[model samples]
Target: MSARLRPTSLPWSVYEHLAMVVGLVSLAVICLAWLPLALALRPVLRGDIGQRLGRLAIMRGFQLYLQVLRGLCACRFDIEAIDALRDQGPMVIAANHPSLLDAVLITSRLPNAVCVMKAEVMENPLFGAGARMAGYVRNDPPLHMVLECRSALRHGAQVLIFPESTRTPGYPANPVNPLSRTAAIIAARAGVPVQTLIVEFSSPYLGKGWPLHRAPRLPLHCRVRLGRRFDPPRDPRAFTTELEAHLRAELAGPKTS
Candidate 1:
C-alpha cells in the first residue's frame, strides 16, 4: 500500500456513513454482550487469568473489527513490528496519536497491554464498564495515572501511552501541543525504556472534527512502524523534546512498500 497519510475524497464516501452506522451498532451489541460477562466473571477470571482473558477479548474484538472494516469499508492495513511487541517487556509503548483507531490497533496486537485512557472514555457507556473491569488505567489526577502505569510496567506488563496525550492536529510539521508529561514521567521513574511507535494512515479519515460519514480514500490504509527504544533520560523536558523530534522524523520518513 502506498503511503499518503492525507485525506482525499473518493466514491466510497457514499457508503462511509452507512458502514459506520452498521459497525457502530454491531460494536454496541458486542460490547453490551461482553460487558456483563466481564462484570460477572470478575471473581472467576481473577488475578492473571482475568487480566489475560480481558485483553484477549479486546484483541479478538479488534481482530473482528479490522476484518469488518476491510470487508465492508474496503480499508487496508500495512502493520509492521506487531510481533515484535510479543517479545518486548514491561516497557512503555509510547505512540504518536493520529486517530482513535490507533489505540485499538496497538492494544489488539499487544494482548497484555495496559492502556491509559481518558477519564471521559472510562465513563462512556460503550467502553467504560468493560475497560474498568478489564484493568486499564484512567487518565486523571496525573499522579494516580503515573503510579498506575508505572506499577503496571514494573509488574512485567506492557503499557501503551499516547505521549501527545491526544489526537494530533493532523499534518506533517504540525505544532506539537503542550500536553501532559505523564507518559515520560512514568517511564523515567519506572526505569523502563520508551518504545516509540509511529502510525501513519494513508487517509486521514477521522481528523479532529471529521465525522464517520466522511469518505476517505477507497480501501483506507495505514503504515505502522517501530522507532528506537530510548532509555529514559534524566531530564523529563529533554526527553519530551527528543521524543517529539523522533516521532516527527518517523512520521516524515519515506513511505514503505
Candidate 2:
C-alpha cells in the first residue's frame, strides 16, 4: 500500500517558509556577530578559552533555534537520560540520524561533547565557523576520527557519532541503516562504552530527503530515549554486530514522538 499523502495547505506552507527564512536570517546574524567578537579576542584568547567561547556561542544558537521552532508550531520534545549521559565521561553516544537537527540537538545539550561531522558540514556557512572554533572533529578518515574521539574522551568529553554515516535513504518510518564500526573501534581503543540514543518523532517533517517546506503535523513531537551501553569486545566484528543488534531492537521496540 502506498503511504497516504496529505495536501499541505497553502497558508500553512507560506507560514513555514516564512518562519524558516526568518529563523535562518536570525541565525546568520548571530554567527556573523560572533565572528567579530572572536577576532577581537584573538590576541587575548588562546586555545581552550577561545574554544570555550565558541562552544558557548554555538550552544546558545542551537537552543535559540529550537525555541524558534517551538514558537512557530506546536512542537514538543521528550528527552530521557540526557542528564544522566552528561555526567558520564569518555563515552561514545551512538545516535540515529533521522533529521537534520540531530547533531544540533545532541551538541547543544551536551555542550562539552566532541561531535563527528561530515566534511560538508564543516563547509556549511551556518555551522562551519562555529564548528571549527569549537574544535569539532571532521569526519574524515575513520582512523583520524577515532583518534580525535579518543583524545576528547580522555579529556572527559562525550563523543557523538551517527553510525549510519549519513541520513539514511529511509528514516525511522523505514528500515534502519547499517551501523558503522568506527565508533566501536574508537570505544575499544579508548576503553569506553557505546551508548545508544533512539530518536523518534511524531512526524517525518525534517526526516531524510524531506524538504523544509513540508509542514508536519502541528506541534511536532520528538522524543529521545537512551539505551543501554555496550562494552566493546576484543573482536571488533563482534562488537559491531552486538551494537547493531542492540540498536535495532531498541529502535524497533516502540514509537515515541
Candidate 3:
C-alpha cells in the first residue's frame, strides 16, 4: 500500500510544482511583452489618450494572466463582484491587502482603475513604465499622493488604494494592519465614495512573508466581495476609524473561499 501511494503522491506533487512555475512564468512573459509598448506610448501619446490606452492594456494583460492561472495553474478566483464597479464612475476603491496579487486581481476587473502603488514598485523596471503610462499614483510624499489620486478621480478614473498600505502581518492572528487615512482623505477631497473590497485567499501564497519560489497548495482559491461603501467623508479621521473597525469585523468573522 505504501509503495502504491508513493507513485500517486509523487505525480501530484510534480504537478503542483509545474503549476507554480507556469503561473510565475506567465506573469513575467506578460510584463515583458508589454514593456516596449508601454515605453513607446509614454512619450508619444500625451494626456488622456495615452493614460487610457495604458490602463486598458494593463487590464487586459492582467485579465489574460488570471485566465492562464485558472486554466493552467488550477487556481480559482471569484471576482465577479469587482466588475460591478467598472462602470460605477469615479470612486476610491479601498481593499484589505492580504497578498501581493491583491492589486492584480482587482485591477484585472476594472479597465479604468488607477492604483496607488509603492514608490519603489512604481519605479521598478518590470512594472514602472507600464504603471507610469497608466498614470498610477505613487504612495509617498503623502501630499503628492493625495493630489495625484484626486486628479485621477477628477478625470473619471477609479482610484484603487490599499488602506493597510501593505499586506497584513501575522494574518489570521491580526486580521488586518492599522488602516491608513489616505484612502479616506482622497475620497473626501475628491468628493468620491470609498468602495471597500474584501479580498480573501485560501492560502498565504505571496503574502507578507511567503516565499516567492514556494509552491502554493494546488487549487488555491481567492474571493473578492463587495463591502460597505462610505460616502465622501465630512471628516476623514473619523472615517478612517470607522473603516478600520468595519474591515476588522468583516475579515475576522469567517473564511470564505
In terms of TM-score, which candidate is strongest? 3
Q: What is the C-alpha lDDT of each candidate?
A: 0.75, 0.73, 0.91
Model 2 per-residue lDDT tens digits across residues 1-257: 11342226666556656666665566677778776665566456767676667777777777787777677644677664476777777788888888876776766677677788998888887667667777678889778877888887887778889887877666665636887788888888898888888777766666778886555655467877788788755677788888778777877866764
Quote the positional error of residue 173 for candidate 3 in Å: 3.5
Alpha-carbon runs more than 4 Å astray in model 1:
1-11, 172-179, 254-257
What's the candidate order when arranged by decreasing lDDT?
A: 3, 1, 2
lDDT (Cα, tens digit) per residue for candidate 1, span 4-114: 332243434456656766666666777788888887887777776787788778877877777777778666776647769777788888887777788877876887888
Give one digit per residue, the lDDT tens place, for model 3 in 1-257.
24653424877678788998999999999999999999987999999899999999999999999999999987899999999998889999999998898999999999999999999999899999999999999999999999999999999999999999899987656778998889989999999999999999887889899888888876789999999999999898999999999988899877754
Candidate 3 or 1, higher lDDT: 3
Note the clash tally of each candidate.
Answer: 1, 1, 0
Model 1 is weakest, by summed lDDT over 10 consecutive residues, at 1-10
